[model samples]
Target: MDFDEYVAARGQALERFAYVLTGDAHRAQDLTQTALLKAYRHWRRVTAAEHPDAYVRRIVTRSYVDWRRRGSSREEPVDVVPDLPEEGASADPAERVAARDELRRALVTLSPKQRAVLVLRDYEGYDDAAIAATLDCAEASVRSHASRGLARLRAVLSEPTVPEELR
Candidate 1:
């Protein structure tokens, strides 16, 4: 497919990947824009790449890691906080909010490499080899990261919950 067509088709998916990486809508947008702009400049080479989408994702992930290393604030800027209530009436909204906040905090605690590996492997549905190729690491490294990342996530998930049983 042509560059324009490819962009139209994959843009949202790319943005979602960035969002998962940064956990902020605005940062995700910025990361997507920066990655896309860089990709556009090297369109010829990127288009010829085996998986251009993966290539762009790598750029986004790398950019986020670099940005974080520069001592930039990780908190997502928000204009207004949404006050949506919990889904089921059986659950207390406050408890749900607390759980969500815990998850977000846990996600932020992960190293950029660990977060990238977990997001790509578990969230993006990528295989070990695909993640290794995208991250330009050995497959064994991917396996190790994914294993450690998942273990950490599981530990976080198992922590005490506001609703007690929700833990």
Candidate 2:
């Protein structure tokens, strides 16, 4: 596919992937835009690859990792937390949002590389080999990062919840 077609097809998916990586919708949008711009700038190089979408995603992931490492000194604290929307009520929206928030917090606890590996492996449903190819790391390293990342997530998620009576 041509660059335009690729962008139209993959933009939303790339946005969601960025959201999962950054855990903030605004930052996710920025990350997606940055990745797309970079891809567009090097469209020839990217489109020549066997899996161009994968290549762009790798760019997004690495860019995020690098930004995190370099921009740590300018971080700002969140002054307020937003409330969850009530759109999906099958499960309590509040609880679901809380769970999502916990997951986001757990994600921050991981190294950027580890977070990227988990997001690609579990959230994006890429296999270890695919992840290794995308991240340009060994498959075993993907496995190790995924393992450690998942253990951290479980630990963060399994902490005390509101009492059953409250729910």
Give the number of the best model, judged by lDDT.
2
lDDT tens per residue, model 1, 21-101: 888888889999999999989998888989888888888878987887787746743222233234573298677877566
| Model 2 TM-score on a 0 to 1 scale | 0.75
Q: Model 1, residue 72: what's the lDDT?
A: 76
Instruction: Point out where model 2 deviates above 4 Å.
Output: 71-101, 158-167
Q: Global lDDT for candidate 1?
A: 0.77
**lDDT of candidate model 2 versus the reference:** 0.78
Instruction: Write candidate 2's Cα lDDT for 36-127 as tens digits.
Output: 99999999999898889888999899888887888661224332223333456528867786757745655666777788998887788999
Clashing pairs in 1: none
Clashes in each model (backbone N, CA, C under 3 Å)? 0, 0
What lDDT is reached at residue 40 by model 2? 90
Worst 10 residues of 2 by lDDT: 73-82
